[model samples]
Target: MATTPDDSSGQSTIDESASQVEILDADALADEPLPEDEAEPVDAVRPPGPSARQPAPLLPAMRPSSRPARSGDLLGYYLAEVRRYPLLDPEEEKELAIQYQDTGDPEAAQRLVTSNLRLVVKLAYQYHRQWANVLDLIQEGNVGLVEALSRYDPYRGIRFSSYAQYWIRAMILRFLMDNYRMVRLGSTRHGRKLFFQLQKERDHLIKQGIHPSTLALSKALNVPEQEVINVDQHLSAPAMSLDAPTSASGEGRPLNEVVGNDKAVNPEQDVARNELGEVFRAQLKTFETTLRDERERTIWHERLTASEPVSLTSLGKRYGVSKERIRQVEARMKRRLRDHLTRELGDEIPIYLEAPSD
Candidate 1:
């Protein structure tokens, strides 16, 4: 019978068969050939070396793999292969982080980021349902992972996984917030909380048979009532393209055509106004011909009708008249012109041509 030693008890037991065992030289033992049935194929075995026992390096960064496959198949392959990268233990993680932090070594940083990529994928999976493309979320999370590695302090006594999770989730949420809709959902702290939690809280209230009013939601979620209403509307309303048909029949006009733009100038009204302006200018020219006094005509044409009307004092100096006298003459001329135009155009005279009431 064969016997074994007890390590814990510090005792050994021996059998007579143990004395017949043969010792072999290390080189001879390694060189010995195995039977055909027990031997590995020559092509399947690698030469013995220190590197043969080492693990393959993880990817330097998250990028599209160079494999010649469809994108979906490639992504699936990447996810499967990334999982095979061995996770770094606390000591290994700390050493790499410290090396990168102290010396700013790219190799150390690469190792630190690549080893923790599995963590980013795990976190990305949690947000997969909220986003359209899982790869986009994973890419965003990888960015967060790199950022976390840069800021990680090995002496903080917290695990790198714990620290990295916050950054990963933040980046994923930011991406979701930015791309989810054309209009942004939340811009304030309370608004952000309400945006992410309002649906869940509302569902809970509905399950309990309580009305999820704006006020009730505001109190439960600690957001303003108006903000709750605004975000709720945003979530409930799907974005509609302006080019989409406005009616159910699909033969109707596009929304962009149906919706009125108040700021747009009406073409018909613009043309009519332009024509009226021309007619008024003709009437003013006819009225200026009726002004028997050259001085009055000069005052009306140069001072009143000029694009930028001359100042009353300046007009008074140019015509060698007292300022008060110039003012009186300007008023009389404006009144006479208004009367003449009203008689000529009747109701068609533009309101702008009417005399200013003193």
Candidate 2:
């Protein structure tokens, strides 16, 4: 059985470090190869271990006695081959950890990693339902495992498996979140939190006979109710491509091909419209300067003319009142702006306001 550091101090340190894991998605991790460089030859990796001084006398058994007919069977080959390496005992594992940490011995580090290949496979299997292919998770897990080896402190007296598992899970969860759909879902911090905790919390509540409503999940995951709803909706949605057929039948046109085009534009009219838009915005700003009350000014700027208007409920909560009160304030501000714009610019100029609907 492979051994690891499991002292109380080490466990506490691991727990604290686990919480401090940076909120980096797979893309950020991918940008810089923080993990081992794949191009480095196994022997070329340094600082060279005792093998540098020892004479070379080894035979490789990686090639099969008889070549199999199957080709491009990478996963199958890995599954069959990984079983050949045996797990290390406690004494041997600690010695290797010390060797690698002290001298940066690639060979010692490789042994420590290979000894725990089974651990990665087992953990990756647990997340099989999350990802279509378990091998991807395994690959990510191995990266984490290698990273853990670089940081592994043999003096901590904690089991390396227990410590390394945290890194492995973090990597796998990030991969799952980043690749949740064709478009990345967990790009933001709160998004990642929801991706990691939403379903887990929902399942817990469900097991306890709770309905797991958006509000309930919001409190359970400590995320905004709207964020929870958005993430939940995204999680349940399937990815669709613009190039995909519009109908189930193969005869259907691609969605992008079937989309309607806008009417032909007149260059003079387009230029006039663009100029009018600038005038309208300038007039709105001039009108905003006339507002004396802070609440009215904020309502006009944030909810009336803004591109993405703040919701009445959100404003009400921020201002400590009912959404109805927010609507009333917004309605009054909009009415003033509209009347001012109509009198100043006449009906010829287009004035647009993004308002909440009833």
Candidate 3:
């Protein structure tokens, strides 16, 4: 015979299944209000949602691999692989340093160097202005990077990047000192500093007419007054004249030609050889009418005529007047005639003044 269900056991089994069914029904009712037993205690703020369902516990993050991986698919493989391994973990880097130091592991050293290529590229940019060529500076900086790697010490407690800075700077500075023509320009520290400062100062001076005084330069460069003066003198020195004319435009007149020479000529020979006799004779006939006195009139006509002129002293002797007085009379008559002729003849006639003879 089938055993009759034990009454208590059957009831307890039914109660457990019913409880599970209730839980399932409640889970299915997504929008149902929370049970009173599981609900948050009444307060000013209400719970955000159903209280029986606690949030799932968060899992800790997995550590990312330092090495980048090559991705593959069922069909094909891509050419490029992102190498996350190039990024150094501090601990892994420390180990690499020890291995390189103790065992001379070239691989470890290579890892360190490849990891820092970006850094070398960065530092090279600082000095590229003076060198102008990026490739040249990069090559120069690679030497610096190698020197930095050779000298990097893990024991000093300072970071490798910090230690490498000094070596990098030393290498770059050596390259600059050797290759830069500006270094030859200024050997002394003061001179070197002033070389750049003086350029700016000179530009400012030229544009605005401001003089670069010794005090101003000394203050600007933090150099001595004397050094400023010496540098300025060198800077301001006039360029040499290459001994060539600035242009081929005209004959270069000498200083002697710019100045003049004065000398006398023989008055008698000059008068006899003169060519303006016809114009003078016409003007003289017109001139005689101005002289009121007969003696003055005769003296004027004979003495003041251009050809065969007599001296003022000879004319004065004939007129019984001092030479100065006769000369004055002759000047008055010539002025009157010049005015008369200029008004009548429209100034086209050339009137030459007779020389006052002794």
Candidate 4:
């Protein structure tokens, strides 16, 4: 049976299946990552090999260029560029996804991603008020798109765009939270909730001629009064240069020195950290024993765990493949490492909020 892109009525112009992935409304975003796991120490261990400099992130840069003066102009340029890729119908999407899954075909994956670039832009628009430059949000969203490609399961019967939207939104939200203030906000889920809502709720109260106090906002939002005060203080606090002196006195110490100058080290914490490092290294060695393929084993040793990782492009040449293919392989290995750790450690694995970079 030949499938039509149109709905059952055959009257709808939009492909309902593709349209399903297109809906990423404000209410659908999640407040935070999973609950804290016991593996907090495990999370601290950088899974990939140590390097002089952090291996470049799998994602694109937060700010690509300083050239774009106004966000609107840059957006207009992107809108035009994204429009060049036509939307993929359901059949086309399924075909591409299945092909990519079977062979790790970069072309298939690229099509799936390019077709949905506009959707990423649409999702990024929802956070326009959160950040001044929409381009930055879109940049993060692109990371999510590539990430989604790495994890997307075509046979699961989920629409690609629908699944990709979650990644898109998550990347954007994380970017917003990270850059929200000079001192990063608390990692608590409640803090994330307050970060998004506290200001809006306060604005509503002010508009209604009611002063938004810690108590009133707490009662209205049903969060703790202290959390409300803490969030409000952070929001209201002005950014200051740490290089500046702590006080107006001419011979005063720098704020950084005065604020966090404690040189005391906790012996227990140091011991526990050392123990966790040993366990992490042990697990990596154990995983290495499980790799059967020559390429997989080489990548594991030379790139993933090497003190200085080989570049993906260089690895690609060694394997007679593209850097993108090398990346896909590296990502798969990391996923396996994560899975191996999860099975061995269960929920005890520490949860670090940031994406892992080797």
Clashes of 4: 5
Q: Which candidate achieves the best TM-score against the true structure?
A: 2
User: Where does candidate 4 stray beyond 4 Å?
Assistant: 1-72, 186-190, 196-213, 216-358
lDDT of 4 by residue, 1-358 (tens): 0122232212223223322332233222221132333211101111222231121232122323334523334444444445555578989998998998888776787678767766776666555544545556677777666666666677756567766665565566666655654224455557666755676577668868989898989988888898888767644311111233322332333322221211222332232223233333444556778896999988766665443557887889888999889778877776777777665433211211111133
Q: Cα lDDT of all candidates, in order? A: 0.51, 0.52, 0.42, 0.53
Backbone clashes in model 2, listed as residue pairs = 4-158, 4-159, 4-160, 5-157, 5-158, 5-159, 6-158, 6-159
* Model 2 agreement with the true structure over 216-294: per-residue lDDT tens digits: 9988877778888777765531111123233324333332222211122233233222322333444555686889688
Q: Each prediction's Cα RMSD?
A: 32.9, 24.8, 46.8, 23.8
Instruction: Estimate the overall C-alpha local distance difference test score of candidate 4.
Output: 0.53
> Can you tell me which runs of candidate 2 are displaced by over 4 Å?
1-72, 182-189, 199-211, 215-358
Give per-residue CA lDDT, model 3, range 14-104, as digits (tens).
1222223221221122223423342111111112222311211110001122233233120011001111114466677778777876776
TM-score for each model? 0.42, 0.43, 0.32, 0.41
- The alpha-carbon lDDT assigned to residue 327 of candidate 2 equals 92
- Model 1 ranges with Cα > 4 A deviation: 1-64, 70-72, 182-193, 196-210, 218-358
When summed lDDT is taken over every stretch of 10 residues in candidate 4, the lowest stretch is: 39-48
Score residue 76 of candidate 4 by CA lDDT. 46
Q: Give the TM-score of candidate 4.
A: 0.41
What's the distance in Å from true for residue 355, model 4? 32
